[model samples]
Target: MVPFGRLLDALSEVPDPRRAEGKRYPLAPLLLFTVLALLSGATSYRHIICFLEQRRIVLNALFGCTLKRAPSLNTLRTVLQMLDRDALEEAFRQHARDLLPPAEPGRMPVVALDGKTLKGSFDHLNDQKAAQALSAFASAAAILLAHTEIDVKSNEIPAAQQMIAELGLSGVLFTADALHCQKNL
Candidate 1:
């Protein structure tokens, strides 16, 4: 899990997707709110909005800002839609890396790699398949180190390779299913 303060600092680096004109809320606060809401068990945007509404004062105090009001569902949707997803993921990984403790002498960290499908993400009406993702997990910390979506046209093997290369993981023991048993890796 990411420390809240570090999470804020990392997320603050992401550029605001909204235009300056008539912008009511800052991106950092909004993103912070969303993350907090998710941590608090919000499963959907409506729940996030509701959570923010119920904890508006506390959130304002925690953020040290008078947002005047919580963001609406539409605001959240628009921001999520427009935000650069790659940048957000990079920030998450960077923050997680910062939180990791140094390796012990002659001991390497254990990293787990796996592919899983997101539950209930299939668009049944449109006959779309569920989303698949390959994730690198820190076994000790029990936190996600990095992940990448497996494109519909592609397979988890390539996604795993890409994610591993992107993370540049070294001096760590990686455990994955036999599907990742490639000579190059």
Candidate 2:
């Protein structure tokens, strides 16, 4: 179903992590640029910056913002790392919802829920475990619905259920590994 809010407005709800004294860019525009860059297949921070610089004028007109250039690599990385994870996740969920059209009657949208451990996330020296998350993907639209971390003290089952409940995903056919087919799912 089509979400009810604008993506930039949704992004604005995410708490800014930068100090007010030296903040160079607005959080919402920087976030929107980053999102657009990722959707355009820019993989690295440098590539994202390059994407912005290359299309600065056009994108500025499109987004209705007059940014002279993209934020520096250091600023982008630091702000991203310091932002509240929950707020960012909520914003992403809303944006993903907005990307879809209304669901048709009698047709079940297929969503695939999967949990996987992220590679290269284990901090060997710090003794941290590999980070894992449960992701819900709208299969037909080829877009992510939502994802949540499987915390060290918890497992995928609760995370999956929580995500499903929070997104209010009724009238949809959800597919998952056998692990998610247990009672109360």
Candidate 3:
């Protein structure tokens, strides 16, 4: 596959889940479009398809393709469902790294550790809890630098510490809610 730009180049590293003969849209662009739509408040596959359809013209220009129409909701859903989770996460991490600004000599990065439970993640039939995640956000760049799932959503301190240790972060200011200020944490 041909590289588009920094973001696309990084994203394109992930192998497409769909077979070559069955693909209608390139994986990188499709993933990027989904990310864009989600960031823009698209809450479902239907909303993502709508977001793409409404922006088809601009998307053609942005991706350097002549798409007659956006993909269907089924297409988007299937592609997403079959994607390799680890590969997608690595691609997103690369994209996030590209979006971050270079460190200034005297400035410390402000990272906010925020937790959220994914919508529609609860499974009553299986007695499962909602999926939760703690993300480290770059306050200045407004980008996600890293994240980890909170196995137990009630306490994010462990997840936050894990993310910080995994990133090997230093000289950084961290922020979070009062739940993170417990004596044991």
Total clashing pairs for each candidate: 0, 0, 0
What is the C-alpha lDDT profile of model 2 across 1-185, one tens digit per residue?
A: 01322778789899887779857788887888887889889999999889888988987777677887788899788888888988988998888887866788888899899999999999999999999989999988998989878998888888888888998877888888898777764
lDDT of 1 by residue, 1-42 (tens): 338778888988887777789478888778888988998999
Model number with the top lDDT: 1
lDDT of 3 by residue, 10-112 (tens): 7789888788897888888788778778878999999999998999789778777666788888888898999898787777777776777877899998999
| Two-way TM-score contest, 1 vs 3, winner | 1
lDDT of 1 at 110: 92
Best by TM-score: 1
lDDT of 2 at 66: 84
Report model 2's TM-score to 2 decimal places. 0.82
* Best-first order by lDDT: 1, 2, 3
- Candidate 3 TM-score, C-alpha based: 0.76
Q: What are the runs in model 3 whose C-alpha is more than 4 Å off?
A: 1-5, 66-68, 117-126, 153-155, 168-170, 176-185
* TM, every model: 0.89, 0.82, 0.76
Report clash pairs, candidate 3. none
